[model samples]
Target: MASESSPSDPAAWLALLDWRRQISALYARVRELRDSDPPAAHALWQAERNRLFRAHSQSPLLPEARADFVSLPCWPYDPALAFSAPVEFLPLERLDIPSSTGQAMPLVRFGRVELPVGTLDVYWIDVYGGGVFLPFRDAGSGHESYGGGRYLLDTAKSADLGSAPGGALVLDFNFAFHPSCFYDPRWSCPLAPPRNVLDVAVRAGERAS
Candidate 1:
């Protein structure tokens, strides 16, 4: 049976709400820039990026943006490495996951799932002109989110980002991971496609406490 949780808990409930708020803010900022202005979108993206790397959502009073960028957690990534090539590269063409909703790239068995998995190539972060980053999740929904078992897609290593070469974008579910919410709820994360949902426990990455 299911039991109720407290809204005042220093951990569980409060953490959940805090996570929602961070995601909400990230989503809100992104929403405002959809068609507003590319430049504005870029700026907001940078700010959101700052929040993701730096400060987290205040768990107590639903905190507000503190110091210009001081209160924020400094991004661990180096701007110079944003365009660096991945250590290694591989090609994928199929993703094996659930996708009754959007487009699904087929793939062979991923993670512990004896079955195949599918990947949705919607949000691709262009790390460099030759490589792109695609974050995703799989069967392990709540068990392991922060790690969510994600992987990167690179063009320098694989075929071109386009359909010119023999590179496929099929993602590996074994790498599914959790979002910033796992470490700190002061961050927003994208939702995993329904097709990506798994019915079993994914014992990788950070677990909810």
Candidate 2:
């Protein structure tokens, strides 16, 4: 352990994140203008994309302890997969959640597959009542995939997910990985949407594969 003494104080950690986020926010701005100005936006666009690559890859963002994946029921709910395999994200348009107010993200299938199991990334991101927020299920729910569809990426709070690109970026299942809940059940997780469920087994990414 690096001694809780080093600038590991909560405030320091927050400050570092805040600084990094300012950079991330700048990238979001560039992406918003891609339609109007392709060339100019592309530069800032690439810069921002690189930053995100580093946020999860370069920077020591998640602590080793928190980053460690544990089977559900033993630890607090941590919804992120520590992926050893690498896959590029396939972008898709934002689809709305069937019954609720949420965005649908398309994810392209990876690895060796049998049929055309399309990849569309979608996220139903909200809940009734205060203090309640989560993602939902769809056609691909349960089965070969996670019984509780993969959790969306969160930047706000661990549970609070962020908005998708203007239909620009959506991560694939090879990268879909697992949520913090898979490691520890003490932590709650979002249930996949009924519409999201699918019959064919999605043999890729994180499951028994």
| Number of the top-ranking candidate, with TM-score as the measure | 2
- Sliding window of 10 residues with minimal summed lDDT for model 2: 74-83
lDDT of 1 by residue, 1-209 (tens): 00122446566666555655664565456435533443453345456544644554433213342343332222222222122121223343333332222223233322221233332343332223323334445554444343333332322222112221233332322212234344434333333444444455444322333
User: After TM-score superposition, what is the CA distance of residue 200 in candidate 1 from its true location, in Å?
Assistant: 4.5
Clashes of each: 36, 37
Write down the TM-score of every candidate.
0.29, 0.35
Can you write out model 2's per-residue Cα lDDT over 80-179, one digit (the tens) per residue? 3111222233343233332211223232222211213432333323332223122323344454445666543333332221234442232223323344
Give the Cα error of residue 196 in candidate 1, in Å.
3.1
Name the weakest run of 10 consecutive residues (lDDT summed) in model 1.
79-88
**Candidate 1 TM-score, C-alpha based:** 0.29
Index of the highest-lDDT prediction:
2
Off by over 4 Å in 1: 1-115, 118-139, 144-165, 200-209
